[model samples]
Target: MLESVLLAGGGSAGHVNPLLAVADELRRRRPDVRVVVLGTAAGLEAELVPAHGYRLVTVPRVPLPRRPTLDWFRLPGRLRAAVRVAGQAIDRSGAQVVVGFGGYVATPAYLAARRRGIPVVIHEQNARPGLANRLGARWARAVAVTFPGTPLPGAQVTGLPLRPQVAELVAARHRDAGRARTEAAALLGLDPTLPTVLVTGGSLGALSLNTAVAGVAADLLAAGAQILHLTGAGKADAVRAAVAAVTRDARPGVALRYQVREYLAEMHQALAVADLVLARSGAGIVSELAALGLPAVYVPLPIGNGEQRLNAGPVVQAGGGVLVADADLTPQWLRSHVIPLLADPDRLAAMGAAARTVGVTDGAARVADLVEGLA
Candidate 1:
C-alpha cells in the first residue's frame, strides 16, 4: 500500500479542516493509499479524524505556556514523549512520506519522519507561517503556501484546499447561476426575497465579530436582512443572550430573521446564501469566500501577526470586500458598511462576482500532486 502520514493536532477547526481536505484529495487520487493522522488526545481530531474515516493516532502533548511558569518544566518530557509516539506510529504505518499541516503536534511527527529517513512536506496555510511549520521547514522536502507571497524557498503557492461541498458550489455557479442561488438559499433556510449576511470567525468563531454583529442586530433586522451566525462553542450562549436583548428592544411586528449555531456542519449552505460576509480574514476563510463568489467585510485580527491582514489585501483590492482594522470595528462601522450593500443589490452582486475571480479551485489537486510525486 502507498502509505502517507498527516501530522495535525489541537482542537482548532482551522488546522484540522485543511488536513482533512488534503487527505480527502489524496484518497480521491489513490484509493488504495493508507493514510494515518497523528494528533493529540485533547484535540478535536479525536472526533473529527475518525468521523472522516481515517485512523487517528493520539499522543500526550501540551502547549508551552505563554509566560514562564512551572509548565515549562514539563515541556521537555512532553516533547520526548510526543517524538516517541510519532516514531511508533510511523513505523507501524510504514509511511513513505509525512505531511504536516502545522500545529504543536506536527513537530514530533516531522522529526520522527526525518529520523526514519522518510521524506517530509510542510503545508503553511497562513501568509505568515506559524512557528511549528517554520521549524519543520528546515527538514521539509517542499513547503506549500496558501497566499500569493510567502518567502520560503521551494515553497509552491498551492492556495487553500476547500472541502468538496465548496468546490461543487463554485462549479454550480459557473454552470447555472440562478439555480445555484436558489439551491443554496433552500439549503440554508434563507428566504429568497431577503438579503443574507454570513457572520463567522474560523470554525470556532470570533468573539469580536459576534459582539459587533449582536450590537447591530437591530439595524439589520429593521432593514429586513437575514443573518447566519456561527458562534464558537465557548461563546454561543453569550451571543444568543445578546441577540435576545436586541430582539427584545426592537420595534414590534418586525421579524428579526436569523439562525445561530455553535458550529456550521454545512458550510456550503451558509456560503451559498450569503450576499455579504462579515468575518475575520484568515487565509482559509478568504480562500472560501473567493471560491464561492461571496463578498465580505474583513476585519483582520489585531494580533500584529500580519497574516490576516495580508490575506485580506487581495480581496479588498479586487473590490470584493472592504478591510476594516480590528481596532476600527464598531457597531456603527458595521452598520454603515453592511447596510449600503444590503440596500443595493447591484453592488452586492458586483462584489460577489469580483470575489469569485480570486479563488483557485484546483488547489487541492495541486497540493495532492505534490504529495503524490513525493511517493
Candidate 2:
C-alpha cells in the first residue's frame, strides 16, 4: 500500500549510505513502491544516488549560515526557496513519507514534509546528532539513531546500516574467515600468509594517520605483519617515500611487503583480508569493521565536537577495538601495543568475536520497519 517515499540526505557516505540502505530496504520489501532521493548537486549524493539507480531530485544547497556575513542575511530567503523546491519534489513524486538522514537538503525536506502533513522518519547516524537532525527530530514522526546515547527526541537505537557487499563479507566472515581471507588477499594481490593490518584515513586521507602509520611500516613488517595501507590519493606519494626510506635501512633479510595504495574499490575485500585495521572512527568505517568482526585501532579525529571519539567508545568497550587520541598514535605506541597484539592470535580472535556481538547487521531492516510504519 506504500505508494511512494522520499529519502532525504547526502554529502558524505555517513548520511548517503544509510539513505541508500533504507532505499534498498524499502524496495526489497515492496518492489512496486517508488523511492526517490533529495540531495544537492555538490554533495556525494549527486554521483552516488544516480549511480545506484535511484531517482535523484537535486536541490540548491543552502548551507545554514554560520558566519556574520551577507549569506547570514540571505538565509531566510534561501531557506524558503529550498523548502518550496522540496515541497514541489514531494508533490511530484507523490511521496507519502519523507525519510531524512540529515544533511543540507534534510532541513528543507523535513520542513516540506512537516508542512505537507506527511509522516517524517528521521535517522540520525552519529552519536552527536548533526544540526539538521537536531532540529528535524523535534518534528519527526519517528526517530532512529545509530548510537543509543545520541541526544535526540524519541530516538530508537538502530545501528548503522551495512552495505550489501559488507553484508556479504559479514556472512563470509562468519562462515569461513580463512577462506574469505585467502580470497580477499588474492583479490587485492596481498600475501595471504602474512598477518595484515589495513590502514585507512578515509577518502581524502588523514595527515596524522598517514604520517604515523607510514613511520611504523617497517616495524610492523618486521613483526611479521604486513601493512595494506590506503594512504588517500594525495597522500600516497608521501607514504611511498616513507616506505622506501624504511626499505633502505632494513635489517639483513627483512623483505617488507608493505602495500601502499591511493584507494581500494573493493573495501569489503580489504576488510576480509585484514587481521587489524588502523583508521579514523567515522561512523561508516567503525560500523563496517564491527559488522565484519574485524579488530581495529580507532584514532578519533581531534576536531569537531569529539563525536568521532564517542563513536568509537562502544566498540572499545566491547573489546572489539582500541581507541587512541590522535596525538598518542606514535610509532612507539604502535610497536609497543600493535606488535604484541598482532603476535597473539588468541587475543585477536577474541576481539573479533566480541566485535561481532556488538555489531548489528540488520540495521537497514530495522530502519525500514520504522519507515514502513509511517507509510
Candidate 3:
C-alpha cells in the first residue's frame, strides 16, 4: 500500500468530486496512508480538500491559452513556475505517488511527479479527454477513464467515481427501490407516492432547459407528475417568471404542482425520488443518473466540442435516456416527448431498469485500486 500520496485535480466539481471520491475510498480501505491535495486557493478544492481531512497545497491558476496573444508568450514561464511550486509540495508531503484528475492542476502535478521519478496516475472523467489529462496520459504510470472510447493511451474504463453518499443511495436504490424512493422522497419533503420529474442544468443552471421545462410546468403538473426544478443559482427568477407566465389566469392550485429551487445541497435525495431527469449531459451528471437508475432527457451544452452530446450517447443508446439538442428544447418538444414519457409508467420503469447497465458504482474503489498498485 502507498504510505503517502499527493492528489492533484480541481477548479470545478467535475474534477474535485472524483478526486475526493477516490480519496475517501483510499482512506476507508487503508487508514495509514497520508493523502495531500494540490490545488488553487480559489478552486473548489480550497474548501473540499481540507474539509475531507487532507493537507492542501495551493499554487497560482494558469489556464492554457487557446488563442495566440501576449498571454501565450508568457505561458511557458507561468507553467514552469507552477511546476516548481507543485514539485515543492510533492517533496514536502513525502508523497510516494501522485494521482491527477483532469484539471488545471493536473499538468503541473504530472510534470513534477515525473521529475521526481514518482509513480503518476491519471483519471479522465469524460469520454473526450481534456487537455491536461490528454497530455498527462502519455507518461502516466496508469490511466483510468470513466467512459469507453476515451482515446487516451493505455486507458482503463473505470467509470466515474460516485461520492460515498451517492454510491450508498444507488446501492440501496438497486436493492430496494421502493423503500429507497420512499425514504428519499421523505428526505426531500416530497410526496412519496407522486411521480416526480427532476430538472437541473448544473450549478449555474442552463437557460434553455430552465425556460423550456418551465414553459410546460402547468402541463406537466396537470399530467399528475410533480416537477422538482432546480434552476441553478441566480437563474431561479427567470424560471419562476416563466412558470408564472405559463400559469397566468389558470385554474387554482396549478402552481402547487411545480416546485422551483435555486439550488439543492441534498441532491442525493432529489436523485432518489426522481422518476426522470431533464438536464444537461455533463459526464458527472450523466454518471449519477445512470448509477441511480434515473432516466433523463439530456440537453448537451451548445459549446465545447460537442463533448456533452458524446457523454450521453452510450446511455441514450442503451435506452436509459433521451438526448435533445439545446435549441430544439421548447414547449412543444416538452409537451410532445416529455409529457408522454412521464405518463407511461411502463416505459419510465423500463428506462430506469436499464440505467444501471450504462454506469457503475465501483468506480471510486476501482480507481483507488489502480492508484494503490502504482503506489
Candidate 4:
C-alpha cells in the first residue's frame, strides 16, 4: 500500500484545516492510500485528524514563544524530543513521502524524513514563509504555497486548499440568487430581511477583533444588522459577556442580533448567510472569504511572525475588503467602514463580486495534481 505522512501540530484551525483539505483530496484520488498525520498530543490535530478517520501519530510538543525569554533554554531539549518522536512515527508508517505543512512539528518530521532518505515536500499557507517552512525549504523536494510572491525558492503557488463544504458553495453558484439566499438564511437562523456580518479571528479568536466588535455591537443592532461571532476558546466568555451587556441596552424593536460561539461548528452556514465579514487576514480565512464571495474588514495580527498582514493584501487591492492595522482597530474605524457598507446594498454586492473573482476554488485539485506528478 502506498503511504503518505503529513506534519501538522500545535495551532488553531488555520493549521489543521488545510492539512485536512489536502488529506481529503488525497483520499478521494487514491482510496487505498494510508495517510498518517504527525502531530503533538496537545494540539487540535489530536481530535481533528482522528475525527476525519485518519491515524494521528503523536509527536513531542515543542512550541516556541513569540518573544524570547528564559524559556529559550528549553529549545534544545524540545528539539531533541521532537526529532526522536518524528523518526519513530515516520519509520512505523513506512511513509514513501512526508509533507510538512508548516509548524514546529513539521521541522522535526522533515529532518527525520531527510535522514531516512525519504522524499520531503513542504506546503506553506502564508504569503510570507513561516520560520519552520523557511528552514524546511532547503531540503524539500517540492514546495507548495497559498499565495503569490512568497519568498521561498522553487515554490509553486497553488492557492489555499479549502474544505469540501466551501468548494460545494462555489459550485452551487449557478442556482437562483434568491433561492441561495433563502437557503443560507434558513440554515443560519437569520432573518432574511436584515443584513448579516460574520466576525471571526481565526479559530482561536483575536482580542483586537473581539474588542472592536463589542464596541460597535449597539450600532450594528440599530442598523438592523445581525452578527455571527466566533470568539476563540480563550476569550469566548469575555466576548459573550460583553455582547450580552450591549444587547441588553439595545432599543426595543431594533433588529440588532447576534449568535456568539467560541468555535463555530457550522462555518458553512455562517459564511453562506454573511453579507460582510470582520476577521483577521490569516491565509485560510482570506481564502474562505474570497471563495464564499463575502466582503470583509481584515485586522492583521500585530505579531509580525504570523505574516497575517501580507495575507490581507490581495483582497484589499481587489476592493473586496479593507485592511486595518491591529493597533488602529478602534470602534470608530469599524463603524465607519462597516456601517456604510451594510447601509449600501449595491456597494456590498459589488464587493462580494470582487471577492469571488479572487477566489481559486480549484486549489486543492491543482495541488493534488502536483503531488500526483511528483509520484
Winner on TM-score between 2 and 4 is 2
| Candidate 2 lDDT | 0.89
Writing each residue's lDDT as its tens digit, candidate 3 over 204-264 gives: 9998898888788778878888788999989998788877887788788767668899999
The runs of at least 3 residues in candidate 2 whose Cα sits more than 4 Å from the true structure, single-residue gaps closed, are 66-69, 249-256
Writing each residue's lDDT as its tens digit, candidate 4 over 126-238 gives 89988888888998888899888899989988888898888777766545555666788887677767788889986678988898888888888878898888888788887
TM-score of 2: 0.97
Q: Select the stronger candidate by TM-score from 3 and 4.
A: 3
User: For each candidate, what TM-score against the reference?
Assistant: 0.90, 0.97, 0.97, 0.89
Question: What TM-score does prediction 4 earn?
Answer: 0.89
Off by over 4 Å in 4: 1-10, 64-77, 174-177, 234-256
C-alpha displacement of 92 in model 3, angstroms?
1.5
Per-residue lDDT of model 2, residues 1-375, tens digit only: 688999999888889988888888888989889989999888999999989889999888778754588888888898999999899999999999999999899999999999999999998888999889999999898999887789998999889887888988888867998899999898888889988999999888898988888888787877888888898877899989988888887765454478889998888899889999999999898888888888999999998888999998898999999999999999888888899999999999999988878788989999999888877
Q: What is the TM-score ranking, best to worst?
A: 3, 2, 1, 4
List all candidate RMSDs to the true structure. Answer: 2.7, 1.6, 1.3, 2.7
